[model samples]
Target: MNLSTSNQPQDSSIHILHDKESSHQELGSPSEDTDQQYHHDWKYALKHYFPHYTYQPIGTVQIEERPSWFYCVAYGIQHVLAMFSGVIVLPLILGYDSNTSLFFSGVSTLIFFIVTGGRVPSYLGCSGSFVSIILTISNYTSTSNSEMNTNTAAVQGAILVLSLAYAVVALVVIVFGCKWLEFFMPPIVTGSIITSIGLHLSFLSYDEATKSSFDTYMAIATASAIMLISVYAPTNALRRIALLLGTMTGYFIHAMCNLKGVGPSIDYSEIASNPWIRAPSVYFNLKFDSSSIGMVMPILIVLLAENLGHMKAIGSITHRPMLRYVGRAYLGDAMGCFVASLTGAVPFTTYAENIGVLSVTQVFSPLVILFAAVFAMLLGFFAKFSAIVKSIPQGVLGGVTIILYTLIAITGIRIWVVNKVDFNDTRNIFVGGLPVILATVMQTPLQVNNFQLDGIGAATFGSIILYQVLQGYDGLAMYRKSIKSAFNKNKPRETV
Candidate 1:
């Protein structure tokens, strides 16, 4: 049925048919006709982007289709739960207020949506990649409280610079497009850096988890629960919340052990005493340290890779050419990072966990994600929620993070696989493997004069430089071959 030219009343709302083919074609990443229809009117685009309407339960809800309010709220909460385990860890470990992090996550997500014109459905979460760097730069583990406060300010400033770098790149992509990014940061380099980050953090998480016998057990239990639920759950929705449920299970077991005097006692005082609803203090002391900025700069590659990879992934799922909107996606991420850095929150990224949820449910409506953002903001206002989050046992956190980091490492490998990165080519092998080795082994920061570079930064620069050097050699070899060919051709006729 050609609904396009129907004589029926033209409803002012954006109408999507229940037909899968029609929905798939019309709904994702505004087509040329849709663009012409809006005539580049952002106000009109914004209104149509988030129209208040309900649709029948089609088999799959594409990015443009808004589901009923009930499904929107339910799925939104599920998204929040899915990402919370991985998202909240960075803040809690870094001593940032978890509530504030939660709030900014939502705010950043909203900003991302507005910047992207609500076309890219993504959830902003605390970037795990920055955790190790921030800790290293701040000397967080060893600093005294007063010194730590100063260090924290320095760290915030570094993040601010990082976001600016990110924004600058986004502007470049917006101006010149994203194709050149492949020349500089191909899958091999991107994948290796990601693997290095995961490996570096895996060691840290493992150490934190195994600090004591009880902690070891808690880590085991937590990881085991998440794995079990994720793999064996009877329903998809149940599997989606595996992280949250696994953490709860670990917490329960830890509490039980504490009651039996087998582990440290549970702390309930803070939860009971904290106010129900209170504003979280905003942290904003930007002290830009040159050394810190140098340390933080390398993460820009990872953020770029993540943002691009996410758009491609979503594009593939929704069957839309999402890379066309890559610039806007990058801009959205940069703005989100800016919001996070300015507000003393960690850098934000497009969450793979929430992406996993979208892939499973086959629902990509931006409005549902909007609901999730609102819910996350609401979570930040309840002081008790933050208290309860804080109350979770350290061992449980250890277990959860270990799994999360390992998955991150595996994701890098996945990138290599998806991109068909060949190890048989000797150049590819060195390009991909050596930098990861450097990052994994170089645990401590390497200092030159007053500047310091961590393992990840070293690996990032190492891979890029190595790749360029190899390309230069290739160019030289070609030139030499061409010269020899020319010489032989000139002499061949006389010799014959």
Candidate 2:
């Protein structure tokens, strides 16, 4: 069920499936028949937003099956918990409204499900892919609240443009097919870009952790806890929430330090003053700065690679033909970003953490994701919840994020490993290794008078250009070899 193999033609390395015609051939029930038979009216119309799944054995749930209401809620909570730690980090780091981010994440998830016909089960949360570029655009030298807010507004405007660009890319995929993408951004290039991004962000995390000695220790404890629980925890449930649990452990330790008068105190005033339920502070003001747009545009590549990788992974696990709907999935993801952009939130991407939950639970039901979205929205409305999220110590977040960032880098390396990218090939060595070096060293923004590009952007465009250049060189070399051989064969009796 590897989407790459399932959809590809025998002769070509990449060939996209005709989603409209071929997608439903392998489906269990006719899409129209199932829709008409089960959902006759308005009440079940809501259910139509969900995908159709047939019954599996008692323990396992497939994409189209409906679980009990209780189980749905239970699994829904599991998904939210798995995604929460990662989702909140982006807004918190960027000084955006956390409540707004939480609310729209749910909204975006609903939009994604509808646009994809509920086939691809995913959660749209604030993306870290934009972090470096946004930071480069914002260029924050002062940490004042007013300045941060100003920079955040400027970043949001750039994000609006980025979102529109993403939607355009999706539209192209829908119309022209995704074959060009495969050739343009082969696994090596995509994987290298991903790795570079991870390395770039890891430095940020490390810097944040080292702000204070106590912070550094807290970070170590948090990362260690996450690694240990994820690797050695006996139960799947514990392993799934390792990030959350590890952060909590670090938070508790920091609180104890405060009691001992050794570390910075946790600010609880916001939590105490906030009402239990309140509307999120959401606003829209898009500013289109050319420099900012240019800085952030490269993130589009990462988003594309991430979405494709996520769908392929899900397809492999579920043993389903997931890529047939990939165009729709991309559209849905773009819509999610479009919605978030209007709300002054960062763009969203498919999360691998939630995919891990699916792999372990073996539940592919989109209904569960729907419930999780509702839960996230409810949490968004609870002002106290946002306050609590905001109150998490910087050190604790530092520790947690360092691990998360490293994981991001590892994901890119995993892509190389899983796809078996050959480093022995000089072309791959240049395409993959060079971008990573640029990403690692160019941690700060590179400035050339009026032009500015961050490490992530540099790595992204650099890899693509290098890949094309190397490909051309290889092609030319092959052509020269053929010419040389033909000339030798056609020479007139030279040896006689």
Candidate 3:
């Protein structure tokens, strides 16, 4: 059954009719007994709400069936580790509690599943797309290990407003369709936005790594470990955990250095002080400022593009017609971001890292992802776990961030490469180049009036306008045709 279709069976009794043959049997009769009909309807609702585990015996692991409990748990943890490096870094960089971020990540994933009818195999995580905007609006300049941005509440309020904008975009995509969005944000524009996000944070990575000479060495060592493991691991499973393993190895080295009194020692005080079980503190109460809204709302475009691209990629991979679910995917993501923003957590989005894990492990079951979400929520409730995560050295994180951030930029370039973007045309070149340049320059923290417009904000909105204006001129298409004709001019004529 193509669940993506609007014509999916709506009859309550359809749940019991497992296959087409069975469905035919039930279609001809309506139960005259009210109690019997009500009972069947209740069962139907339960089946749709929470499906049972059924083995397919002969197909790729997919949404419809659940794997064994043991396999589910194992793959679930793998998914968590795949996304851990990306998810934890956001809160650490932005100075929010990592535990709360984990909690919301899990909650958001489940929400995504519910909205998409448990069809999409995506895991929601902290989005790098929002980093530059948050930093700009909060006016955060401190790179130290201490407390960050005193005005985080204001940033939270801006995020809350931004969530509404996401919903509006989702609604538009649902009602009018994604074609309208594609008119403005093509591969060139979207790719540039992705590239700009990584470039904008390059400075932060360097700053974190170079805090001290010893730290710089540790950072290099940590990055080396990740590289070796990711590239040379004997098994796919080990490769999946490369980031975690590398970080742990770096921690061991740091511990030894501390024992020799040559490097900063691990501070166990936070772990010792924190209770085993405690709720995440409520820090992001909304305080809507109009200026903050302008600074942050532009990010909605970037997030929309990111989510849409991911959905398309997953669709292509699973060979499922996912276009119909695009609207629900956007709405689900927007809802997750809205919930996360309320609690001072970073906004959520479909994670490409987890998708990579799915690709590698060949495990596409949604049930495994659900297990991972539960594990993430459990981590959030444990204060000790949060403290332990906090104990990870900044130099170590910087090493991983250096790799991850660089990959993000490279991923953007790959988008163009994969799409066969015609850079021969000057229009494509200008569309791609200008946004990246503007975004990179704006990384220095530019502002107008009370609004702090970061590189990402400029690049995203700027690309949209540039593409539209260039499209109006229609010069690029003509130039591209001319280039093609010139190349063919020297070729020998073929006999017809």
- Each prediction's TM-score against the native? 0.84, 0.84, 0.85
26-75 in candidate 3: lDDT tens per residue? 77545465456556656665566544546744447765577778888888
Off by over 4 Å in 1: 1-56, 142-150, 473-496
Candidate 2's C-alpha runs over 4 A off are: 1-50, 55-57, 140-150, 448-450, 473-496
lDDT for predicted candidate 3 compared with the true structure: 0.75
The 0-to-1 C-alpha lDDT of every candidate, in the order given, reads 0.76, 0.75, 0.75
Clashing pairs in 3: none
**For residues 40-145, could you state the per-residue lDDT of candidate 2 as single tens digits?**
3333444444445555546768777757888889988899889865567767776666787788888888888877767778888766687777666666521112
Deviation in Å, model 3, residue 286 alpha carbon = 1.4
Using lDDT, give the best candidate's number: 1
Tens digit of per-residue lDDT, candidate 1, span 1-496: 2323555323232232213235546667455566554443444534555433347487888765777889999989888888875557667776667788888888888888777656678998877678888888767751101121235778888877777778888776665556667666778888887888888777777776877898899899999999999999999989988888898999999988877889877778888999999886677778888998888888888788777777777877877556656777777778877876677777787888888899998888888888999998999898988778777777888888888888888888888999899898898899889988998888889999868888888888898888878868674565565455434522211000
Clashing pairs in 2: 52-64, 53-64, 53-65, 157-287, 219-399
Ranked by lDDT, the better of candidates 1 and 3 is 1
The segments of candidate 3 whose C-alpha lies over 4 angstroms from its true place after superposition are 1-53, 57-59, 141-144, 148-150, 473-496
